[model samples]
Target chain A: MVALRRAAGEVGRSVAVHTRARPAQPQLHPNPWDTYHHTVIEPRRRLGLDAVRRGMERGEIRDDLDVELVGDLFTGPLLIRTVIRPGATLEPGLAERIVDTVLEGLRPRT
Target chain B: MVALRRAAGEVGRSVAVHTRARPAQPQLHPNPWDTYHHTVIEPRRRLGLDAVRRGMERGEIRDDLDVELVGDLFTGPLLIRTVIRPGATLEPGLAERIVDTVLEGLRPRT
Candidate 1:
């Protein structure tokens, strides 16, 4: 949970910084989507994947889990709020709530 | 689970249709984001919320679960793949997998 929280926090902070730096007008680029994926999505995805991997190593997560899908579950909702759907507020502790909910679901059952 | 599956399938089909109809170039609109929210996001979100409500009433989901967050967990991963992250493939049975995984976690414990 701590690793996941750190990963989520880092991604949230980076995205917040990026959102603030974005220009009002949409900029013309060869492929803004690709650029965004390379710059923001990929790195964050790696962070999430790493967190999930570590959790599995510690026997906190299920051994049979799909690592990528688990990562998406952790970050996708928060990402939608921050990037895709700007109207939704990133309330305090939203990331932690997301992490807790997903982890609770994903944790190994006795 | 049936209600949630129906809701998810409807949202996925509608999104597929919308994606096919979208122009190659980004269209000029006064508020495309708001338009999308009204036309797509809002309606789909409501469907997910309804599904969660129905699950609770049926005793399939926990009574204390946050409907909105649970809804997000069900749909957010698929949404990111289809709409936000276009490169990812929406493989067959992906929706069902997401639904089952989340439902397993959220279901009432005896």
Candidate 2:
């Protein structure tokens, strides 16, 4: 009787452990709409922040740009509108904002 | 006396005509400074106006851009800052002005 009881206890413990086990973490693929839906690009959110961070580390942006970020990424032209439409252009003073965003995005994720 | 007078008159008239013969027109190579010395570019003055005119002829801008210019040339990005300085960017509403300049430059020289 004791042996049977012990076996049941063992089985119960095994089931409990299994119920508490961690589930698989899903791999993240950046969606294009989620990635580039913004009129201006956000490098970090888009997964291209790595290059900006690398560039910041390399001093390309800080050298001529009079500034530096946590990483070595160039925040300026790293995200210029590749195609400014015929009747449209970015608002005045927005380039600097884009530059700032690109640089900040390059900051090493702690 | 009449023959002598006629000969002298003919010689004078001929000499005047020789002096006044149309001066040779100089071949113009656009000077870089002359072509693009402004804060914003002027397409016609730059000697690149020909391309703009051709683009206007093709109707490419009118079809998609909601507007047509003297030339099919796109005045917008065609004159964007190839490099916006680190501390710099264009002023407000200047893009449309640049577009206008590019279009006017494209107007066929009648």
Scored by lDDT, the top model is: 1
lDDT tens digits, residue span A1-110, model 2: 22322332333222223222312211122343233323222332233334333343554332322122211122212221222111234344433333333323211223
Which lDDT tens digits does candidate 1 get at residues B1-110? Answer: 57757676666445544643443433345376567757866776687678778877877766676777777777677766654456677787887777777656532344
> Who wins the TM-score comparison?
1
DockQ of 2: 0.01
| Candidate 2 CA-lDDT value | 0.27
Q: What's the CA error at residue B48 for candidate 2, in Å?
A: 7.2
Worst 10 residues of 1 chain B by lDDT: B19-28
lDDT of 1: 0.64
lDDT for B103 (candidate 2): 27
Query: Would candidate 2 be rated incorrect, acceptable, medium or high by CAPRI criteria?
Result: incorrect
